[model samples]
Every structure is written in structure tokens, then in C-alpha cells.
Target: MRIISKIKTPGALKSSTSNLLGRFRHDDDGAMSYVAVTGALIMMVFGGIGIDMIHAELKRNKVQNTLDRAVLAAANMDNTMDPEFVVQEYFRAMNMSDALSGVSVDQSLNYKRVTADGNATMPSNFMSLLGVDTLQASGSATAEHGLTKIEISLVLDVSGSMGGNKIVQLRDAAKGFVDLMLPADGSDMVSISVIPYNATVNLGDTVSQYFTLDDVHDYSSCATFETNDFTSTAVDPSTELGRLGHFDPYNSSTSGGEIAKPWCATGQTSAVIAHSSDADVLKAHIDTLNAGGNTAIDLGMKWGAALLDPAARPAVQALSVAGFVAPEHSSRPAAYADSETLKFVVVMTDGQNTTQYDLKPEFKFGMSEVWVDTRGTNTLNDDRFAFRVQDNAGDDSDVYYWLGNSGQGYAMKYQNRPESSAISNGVEPYQMTNAELYSRFSIAAVASEFYYPAYVDGFLTYDDYANAYYGYQATVNGSQADTNLSTVCDSARDNGVVVYAIGVEAPQAGLDAMQDCASSVAHYFDVSGDDLNDTFSSIARSLQMLRLTQ
Candidate 1:
């Protein structure tokens, strides 16, 4: 009965239910604690995943940088290097071989491009719980190279100022530049023309015949341009334009004996080399460039620009036939609009322009001769005032003489001389003063066997004597030379020539000329003696810089 009451009574029942509830609550608390621990573990795993992702991103950045450099080095225009191998070598060098894949290369005449894409997978330190066993990092890089067909004309100043170390430095720097511009293997992609200019631009023996000679003195390779030449941009040899002579300034009377006609003729000619693709040939020619004579910037610029002028096609063609140029480049001095070709001129000078002189004959020799004999008595038989003139005797065997001065009408006398026939001494002589007779004889162009007695008046000055004895034209002074240089430079620029002027330890005149000649002031370089190599290298690198199009 007591056990039944405990099982059935309200107090006993309530107590039993409370005990069950308390047990249930205890179980709930245990389950909640387990859930909190699980949440913390999951959070820790996610945080590790974030850290791994950041590490992978860092690795990707490093790999991309390495690959970028690799592609650039591999895509350079050296001896056709294998792009894939070069990239692989770079990765190996960087100790990132696992990050390289999908490498490719493309090349053309004027451009070379390379692309490399790669990826790396990092073992997961966390996140494996969610099946993210590893993290992938990828990178890609592309690089393009620049190489273009170039036709360059170097108008070098071989003037007296470029004599000692200046020339040596120039030679070394120029040779180095050539080495950089030219491929180790032979290629016609680049052609260079060297024009060493002084008082004149010598087109060499082969290039001289292209012009018609104004004078019979092919003895010199120098020629002065007429005003028309400055106005005209085309250096067309077909125009029959200029006279060819030496650098002799003719003088009939001087401390030394009379200088023969064409006084300035007979000096060393300039050295000119046509366009050549062979670097060795170019360097050899540079070695032969000696320094002498006055500076003629206009002449140098003119000839240099002429070589790049479209009008010079005939000359270029002739050169090609003569084996001075490659046959494939026959169309050189290519049309200005040709995008595939670039024409560049590098003009260097260390000094300013100087006076230029040419020959101008005043008289014709063997045509006539006049002479005065002061020692002889005139027709009046006056002493100390006698004068005589000689003329053609009409007949080869006869001679005619006229004597008078002091305003006394002349008297004509004939003397028979059959041997004087070659002199054309048969004409009647006319009265003339000593000064007048001297002037007449000085102007005679033909060779005459005439003699003159000493006179009191020094009728002709040194310059006059020079002009009369030899055919020196009026002198073109420094100012005129500069004007001419500017003229020719302008013409060249108009024709689309890209000029780069470098002045080494030059004067103000030189600086001005170079500034005017350059395509822009930025293209001009004003360097001291030792900085020449740096300037040259800078230019070479600029020309060789890689151009990335993609």
C-alpha cells in the first residue's frame, strides 16, 4: 500500500517529472558547449585559408615580375634566340621553375613580341576541411622589341679643329655605336653613309663624275654651290651646275712667286663613303677620315641630305651598279612617305664656318697683249718720258709699235718681224699710260710672252693681283657661310630628314649651327671633350630601346 501511494501521489509524481526536466536541461548545456567549440574550430580554419590566399598572391606578384624580365630578354633582336628556352632559363635562374607555362613568341622585320603565362599551386595549411586542398597562383607577362630599317648619314666635321684626341674619341665612340646598331650576323636592315667634310665634301673619284664641270679643273674634288643650289633641295648632278677646283687662292704678286690660276685647287679632297650595310666597311672608312681644311657645314649638310633625297635616285642607282650599295636597296632615298624606312642624319662639328673662295678668270690669254716701254724714246724723241705700246702687225712677219704718253697723240710705226707671227702683232698700237697698260696685261686670260718695265704706281693691291693672276671669285665670309648653312639645313628638314646635331667643345657659332640643324633642340647635344662617348651611347640606346605595342 505505501509503494502504490508513492507511485500514484501528486508529490511523488511532480518530484519525478522535475528530476527528468533537470536531466534534460543538463544535456542541453552540454550540447551548447560542444557547438561553441565547433564554431571556434571552423573560424580558425577560415582564418588560415585567408592567410594562405595572401601568401599565394605574394608569390604570384614575384613570379610575374620575374617572367616579365625573362620575356624581355628573350625577345631582343640578337641572333634569333628561342623565346621558350630563354624564358625557362630565366625562371630557373629565379628559382621559380614551377611557375612557368604557356610561353609563346612572335617576330617580324620591325617588331618582336613575346608572351609568357604561368601558374603555381601552394599546399593548403588549412581549408582542407572544405575540400580546398591547395591554392593556385597564376601570372602572365608580355614584351615586345623594336627594330627598324634605318638609313643613316653621318656628316662629320673633319675640319682642322677635330685633329688630336677629339678625332680619336670620335672614332672610338662612333665604332661602338656601329657595333650596337649592327647585328652580329650580316643584315641589310641598316645602311650607313659617312661624309667627312672640311672646306668641301669630296664625293670620291667615283661620285665626282655625276656633276658637270664648269671649269676644266677636275684636278680638285671641291665645288662651291651657287645661290640657286641653296634654293634647290635636290642635289641633282644632271643640272651641270658647279665648277670643280682645288682650295688654292690664286695671287699673281706676293712675297712668294705668283700663284698659278685656280689657286685653291690642289689640296686634299674630302672622304666620302656611300651607304654600306657592313659595319666593318663603315669602321674602316671612319679610320681613313683625316682632319684638315676649313669648316664648310653647308657643303656637308647639302651632300648628306642629298644622299637621302628622292631626287638622288639616279646617283644611288649608279652606286648600286658600282657595287657601292646593295642591289636590294635600289629604291633608297626612298619616298618620304614610306613608313617602313627612316632616314637619319647625324651632323657633328667642332668649329664655325669660314670664308669660301672660288676661281674667276678675268681675261683670255693669247688673244691680245699690251705693253709700255718707258726706257725707249717716243716719236718726239723725248728723254725720260718715252712710252711705247705693242699691237698686232697685221701680218705674221710684221710688228707694229705706237709711242706716246703726255697727252701727245700716238704715232704708229711698223717693224717687219716674220717670227712674231704667233703673237698676232700686226695691229696698230694705241697710246696708253703705264697704269693703263699694266691693267690691260693683268686682265689678259691667255698665256702671253709680254714683259713690263717697273712702274711707280702700285695700281693693283694684293687681292687684285690674286684675282688677275688666278681666277679667285669674290670671297664668301663667315656670315655668308652661316647663311648658306642655314639655307641648306632648312631644305633638308623640309624634305623629311631627321637631323641630330652634336657639338663637341664647340664655339657659339658651332652651337648655333647645330641647334639650327637639329630636328629639335632636344636632338642636339652639346658635350665637352670627354663626354662624347656617353652622348653617343645615349643616342644608340635610344635607337635600340624596346617598343612594346601590346
Candidate 2:
């Protein structure tokens, strides 16, 4: 039996095809695979973008760090090369020279400021798919090296203990410091005041004229400050000060044109050279320093702080007019609140504070009881004598006199009835003032001739004679001097003044005092021999104020 295939009509085939298509569209099989492929594509895009962003950040950080270092190095005051060149070299060393866009340098006599800007362009990797062809990394930095105005006070110890090699080393170290601080081009922005101190601070005649000093004698220009003066940094020019006596307690004779060594040094070497920018003048003054007196670190610090105080501006201006201070520094000792100015004080000492002598108020001025006969030879018993005159009535009535060896040769009391004829002929009695007495004879000679005779003649008691013998007394003891130093040091720091102290082979007390006076522990130096030079050099480096501003 042969069978024939049946064929469907066109309409029936179309209906069957439609039914198959609908089933295919409704089926859920393999639907998860399509979602999985879309998710993977999204994840790949995000990961690539993150990687490109991290790479750009790394490049940005590198540019910023390199620019910061370059500006800082270029701003260094000690860098002799061109600032722009220095910055360029720094970038070249980092192999990022092409990234440096620009460099700017601003410099003055004592100041230098540098600014740098850089940018790096990196090709975008995965980010390119988002139409970003390149990424830019940019950085900027600024640095400042020096202060606009710098005032420094060098308080050097020229005491007897600083003799020999110690002084030589100090001179070399201090000169080296000057060379570092003061540029050879003669910068007007820096001024140094050299205050060489020992028993007292000698304000040179040019500087002393700006102050109101007691008119005791014209022999020296040393002022005796009160205890309260150390509590503040100001040395008011209008403040009247007591004058130290010009008598020497060591020598007994004024023969052979020998000058008395007064409590205050009289020579130009020990005097303060205020607010000078001339290194040669300052070094010359340092060369003349001779160690011969006791230590007075307190006085030295006081003058050092005072010279940096704004209250002393008038005196500085006066000094400038008088040619002692540089004319460009006439306005110096800028206000403490001035942001553009910086002040520093360097105190060096080899010993602790010693006795500071001052004449008693009674002996400071006015007539003394001692009398001299100008006609006789210059002998203690014949020429100079003291009279013990007593008013019996207590109302300027009858007076009794005990004449001291005026050729009468006896301790006899004579009534007021003795006229000029009663005494020996040609024996002219001259009542000398205390100032005159001290000016003519040494303190030792006066004590020997006058005080001893008064005690022997029963006019003065033994205690009274002892007091009179030592005309000068200690004004401030060692302990009190140390306290004064602390007070001044604190005031200086409070006023924004940087204090650096050095103890060169000093005793324990001296070292402690210097350490306490320093602004911080790092600001104090304990050294000996040649180490002082290194200490000063370190200080010079610290004072340059090199720092990054941005």
C-alpha cells in the first residue's frame, strides 16, 4: 500500500509559526545569563575608572611634594646660586623638569622669598572611554628665608676670668657670627649692639648723653640701676640713674699717672656700641677688649635687652644723629608687636655674678669732713688731715675742734677762738668735696689717712671706721643678681625676644644662671675651648628663619 504526504494550507502554516514565536518569547530559560553579561560589563568600566583616578592622584602628590621641597631649598638664605636656577635644578634632579611651569623669587638685602608652580599632564587609560583624553595634576608652593628687620645684642663677658685663650677663642667665634649675620654688601636690615660687660655696663659717652645720669663725675659713663629696672626690658632714657664712683679700692697711691680702675670700665673697649651694622667697627671694638674687672652678668643682660626694646628707639635715633648708630637704623628697635622684625640676645659668661659696688649716698657727692693743707708736701700726716668738729650747744653755737696732726703735734681740743694767726703760717686749710677727694686720691689712700686717724683720735668708733674705710658697698649680692637675671630673661622671652646663652668653661653657678636665662634648653650652650665657635655657628644658622610658608 503506497501512501501520499499531506501538505498544510498557507493559512495553517502561518498560524503554527505564530504559536511557536509566542512560546519562544515567553520562555524564562537562560534569562539569567543575559543579566550576568550586562553586570560584568558595568563592573569592568567602574574598575578601570578607579585605577586611572588613583594613578592621577599619585602623580599629583609627587608634583606637590617636589614643588614644596624645591621652593624651600631655593628660599634658603645661604644658597648663593640664583633662586630660579635652584628651583629648576631641584625639578631636574627629580626627572620632572617638564612639569615645572614657573618660578618666582623675591629678595632683599636680608630677606628672600620663593614661589613655585608646577603641573603634570598624564594620558588617561580607562578614563579615555568617557571622552577624557588626559588628566592634569597641579601644585604650588612658597617659602620665606629671612626676617625683614633683625636686631641682635651680643652681651660678651670681658671679666678677668675671660683672659688668655678663652678671650681669643671668643673673639674669633664672635667675629665669625658677625660675618654670618651681616652680609658683605652692608645690609641695612640687620643691626648689632655689642655690650662688653664686666663689673658694670659702660654706656659709651655717645650713648650716655641720651640718658639722664647723676652728675657725680665726668670720669666714666656707668649707671647704677635699681632692682625694679630688671623686671622690664625698657631702659627709659628719661629715668635718672646713679653714677658709680670713680675710685679704685685696690691701689693706695695715685702716682706715676696711674689711672684708677673704677667699678665701671672707663676705656672705649668696654663701652657698648649700640645698633651698629658695621662689622669692622664692631670687630675693632672687640679687639680692644681687655679683661680686668669682676663679673656682672645681670648688668650685661639688662643692657642687651634694653637695646632691643622699643622704648630705646629715641636713644637709638639720637645715636644715629650723632653718627654712633647707622642712620638707616634710626627707626630700629621696632615695636615688639611688629611682625616684620625679629630680636635676639646672646649672653656669654665665664663666671657667676660677683659684687657690684656703689658709693654710699653720703659719699656720692657734697663736702667731706677731711681737710687738706695745700702748702705742705703731699704726705698723709702733714698735707691731708680730718677734723672732728663738735657743736656743744647743738644749735650752731660754740664749737670744739680736734685738729689732726696739723703740725700742732698733739690731740688737743681747741676753742673757736683760734684765728688764722693761731695756726702755723703758710698752712692753708682747704675743705675738699667728696668728689674732689676721690678724684684726686685712691679710696685706699683716703681710708688710710682719714678714717684711721678719726678712729685713733676717738672721733669715730671702730665700727664706724671700718664702714668708712670701705666707701663702696655691694649693691646686689650674688643671689640677688641671679634673681634679677631670671626676671630680665623672662621679660625678654615674653616680649618675643629670642635669648641664647653660652657658658664657656664656667662654674656650676654660672652655667645654671645661663641655662635659666635661655629661651629654651636648646638655646643654651655649655662648651669649652674651641667648641664655642661651633655653638655660635649653630646659633647663626637657627637665626636665618628658613621655613616653608606654603
The candidate that achieves the highest TM-score relative to the unseen native structure: 2
* Model 1, span 329-381: residue lDDT tens: 76777877788777888888999988766534333112223333323333322
For residues 449-525, write the lDDT of model 2, one tens digit per residue. 65666567675688776776778778898888998999999999999999999999999999999999999999999
User: What's the lDDT for all of these models?
Assistant: 0.66, 0.82
**Residue 21 C-alpha lDDT in model 1:** 79
Q: Where does candidate 2 clash, by residue pair?
A: none
Can you give the TM-score per candidate against the true fold? 0.62, 0.82
lDDT of 1 at 350: 92
lDDT of 1 at 112: 71
lDDT measured at residue 444 in model 1 versus the true structure, 0 to 100: 33
Worst 10 residues of 1 by lDDT: 446-455
**Stretches of candidate 2 above 4 Å error?**
1-53, 107-112, 125-133, 144-147, 254-259, 267-269, 372-430
